[model samples]
Target chain A: MATDLMSNGNRPSAEDIAARRKVIEVDRLDFAFGARQVLFDISLDVREGEIMVVMGGSGSGKTTLLRHLVGLMPPQPGKVKLLDKDMGALNRRQLLDLKRRIGVAFQFGALFSSLTVAENVKLPLRELTDLEERTMDIMANMKLEVCNLSGFGHLMPADLSGGMMKRASIARAIVMDPKLVFLDEPSSGLDPAVSSALDDLILKLRDAMDISVVVVSHDIESAFKIADRITILDKGRILISDRVDAVRNSPNERVQNLLHRRSEQIDVDPTEYLRRLAGD
Target chain B: MANPAKFFEQIGRRTASGLDEMGYATVLFFEAIYWTLTGWRQRQPVRIAATFAAMVEIGVAALPIATLLAATIGLMLAIQSLYSLGIFGAEQYAFIGIALSVVREFSPMIMGILIAGRSGSAIAARLATMNINQEIDALQVMGINPNRFLVAPVLIALVVMMPCLAMWANIVSILAAGLYVSAELNQSFGAYLNDTLDVLKVDDVWHGLGKAGLFGIIIALVGVVNGSMVKGGAEGVGRVTTRSVVLSVTLIVVADMIFAYLTTR
Candidate 1:
């Protein structure tokens, strides 16, 4: 795919040109669901061949941001450029064409219940490529092996445990050798041992395939372990987006609170509390 | 006075929602049509496999129920016509009434309603489950058009098989009615056969089959559109599945009425 020229049509500055080389870029993105604004002026970038972990509390708009990156949700008030093309400018065909180079493992694994793990992994290649069936099968098995799900390929999604299903979902996501992959809550429901192993697998995939990864997770240990950079969001706003060490050392109170898992004390007015209880 | 503003507001909301639903169904219908026509050029094996699977599910599987409905209705119609016409000493024309009604209206309408309830609800529920589970999103992320991958095969199956099912229903109903008239109603076999042949025309069969084909498209559109729009979870799936059945039956009935009027005219 040819890199699309920037929409501004102006010659980019040196720093701007450097930023263009990044695999994913979001500039002042704002998103709302109905009357509720969920992502407020969110800005971040994921550089090539790096894992960028997006961490947030529940309902902090991490999934919404991921949706925008993958073209499921359109930009509302800001820019999301992926793979050197403006996401807002692409037509349906162009968006789909661009999606071929991207992979997403959803929060729940999201494997097709009707198909076996092997068939699920083979779906991308089968739909988008002219590869022979034998070759496709071989490639699917290879991906399953990569995700440590080799012999489990013949089983239906219902047959797999949570960790195994997540692995299978990862296998399917990376089967087509996407240049960029998005993983949502990969460690959410796993035991620490399995979660740690998944973290290692994620890093291994990055090194082996040289693919950029954007992971949305609330698992502090997994994020700190796997991310080259981390972006922490709180209440639809980014507290900090920087390298792991910088994030850990940041003076921002919210960042510190999040890093230390501190829950702030609430000071509610007595009159307001009484009014709420009285249904006023 | 009752809240006039709220009453109008409710009416306006319902009208808008109905229009929105119609638009969604229309867009899905055209997308299914476009994919079905161009799908051959792409030669996607999965698509072809889905198409065949749908054929077996929608067509072959519905055969027994369709046959039973047709036979039962045919027998009832024959008995009713014989008793009613016997009052005027016109019992010999019972086969004519039975054949005409079965071929021109009952077979297509009954089969349409039955398939709408069975297959339409099934399609909606399956798609709603896929949606809730995020498999649909997974397909979209993989650059696969979900409509092309899922809806086209179903559209093709329903359209092609609906007429075939109607034809089967037509035959079984006529045969069942013929038997009832000959043995139970004390009419001769030769008289029943001759009366049926005289009353039934090629145009009648074509009209019924054509109506059945339209009903098939209605069911496909309602099922897929409702399914694709499903949100929430298991409750949403059940709700949309029921809605798909109701909407499909309503649309089939309306379409059948139009076809009946045009054919009779």
Candidate 2:
């Protein structure tokens, strides 16, 4: 049962999985904003055609780690290699070229408000390809259709509901047919049913597109549903990186607290509490 | 009392940050210029449609207010100059003074200030909102340079439109002053117009247009710099919008003063 769950009954053997290419590799990455450290000694990887979910509570630096993977923030005191190319070592032109082979869907669906939904999806194509206008339009509509957003291309992003907007954002992310895709909080702010649907969509996307996916999320249910492997973070440090079943049965008290949705118990000192209340 | 070391440290930090901002703005300005010239060669050509839309937004939309303000300045110039020159019984020469000042100085300066408040604030707010939404970051991830895709078209449009608006202001202001002075002197409007034309040199018109272009560059660079540097979300956008306007206006005035000093010397 554990093997079936881990391999999804159809995936390659353990040896084959181990031999698969690493689409994303992070080694001892650390990040800081001013004097405040956000990510500490983080190391993880996403194998080709696998869905890797990086999950954590709020302020655990999940988003910060995702940013480093996408090359939005440089890895300080460490290295991030995407598709075997070192992110920190790439020049501007090299980085741009590398970026073309990956897609990132931001948490908030970050579509350009001024453009129509179709135009928003087509932006990368328009900016990076010299394709004919008609061809670009067709390609954009096709991607939108894949996200179940067909026939809604003419509307502005402002006109779409939250779900439709997120779907459209995913369409834009995959418009370039990238080998790797990063989704920031893909199921955030959705109803349970909708969230489940999004998880299914992600799994379907990875299988159909043959692309590796990195999802930064706090939604444990969605992560369990879609993630082949999960990396749980706490306070800017990785607590567990393993298969879903192993993570579920882990003996770590913090892991159990997170997995069971148990609220953290804090033994607040009376003097500190009083001082905090008094604004001292 | 402030600790001397702390005070010095604060000053040093501020000066360093200020210099860093100036350097970034300088690079952004030159990059905009470079992209404006060469962006067409890229996979995504420089968007002429976007540039035209910005021209309509920054220039055509401001036309009515600019004309009204120019006419008011002209009327005020006529009244005040006439009063002063009237003491010397030289009120008849007020048109010459108005023509020289409006054509060479006031028109461009007033238009620059107006644009700083109007379009400069708008540019800053728009870009800052985009930044807050992560649209700029999204653009970078998509291999689209925001400077090429967003800033260059706006810079090009403003540089083209500012001189055009300034020329219109010059005409309107001079005409307003002409009509007022002709009626006051009980002379024909045609005679006053002729006097004005006679006093104004082509050099003065070109000088004002040149200043208008410089002010356009200042406003665009300031807005882009402030917008791109915004943090802390919506409040940050509002803060940068105000800063863009204030900084553009102050810089325009200072640049005008420097130009005046250089030309007169």
On lDDT, the candidate that comes out on top is 2
lDDT of 2 by residue, B176-254 (tens): 9988998999999999988888888888899999999999999999999999899898899999999999999999999
lDDT of 1 by residue, A39-109 (tens): 99998887777788899888999999998998888898999998988999998778877998999999899
Measured against the true structure, the TM-scores of the candidates, in listed sequence, are 0.92, 0.93
Residue A271 alpha-carbon offset, candidate 1, angstroms: 19
Model-by-model DockQ, in order: 0.63, 0.81
RMSD, one per candidate, in order: 6.4, 3.1
Model 2: per-residue Cα lDDT over A123-223, one tens digit each: 99888988899999999999998999999999999999888888999999999999999999988888987877787778878888999999998888777
- Candidate 1 chain B weakest lDDT stretch, 10 residues: B37-46
- Residue B254 shift from truth in candidate 2, angstroms: 1.2
What is the Cα-based TM-score of model 2?
0.93
Across residues B1-265, which tens digit of lDDT does each residue of candidate 1 receive?
8899999999999999989989988988888777777755654333777888998999999998998998999889988998999899988778878888888889889988999999999999999999999989898888888889998889889999999999999889888888988997677778778779888889888988888889999999899888988989999999999999999998888888787787687
Stretches of candidate 2 off by over 4 Å are A1-13, A266-280, B1-7
Tell how far residue B42 is off in model 1, in angstroms. Answer: 6.1
Best by DockQ: 2
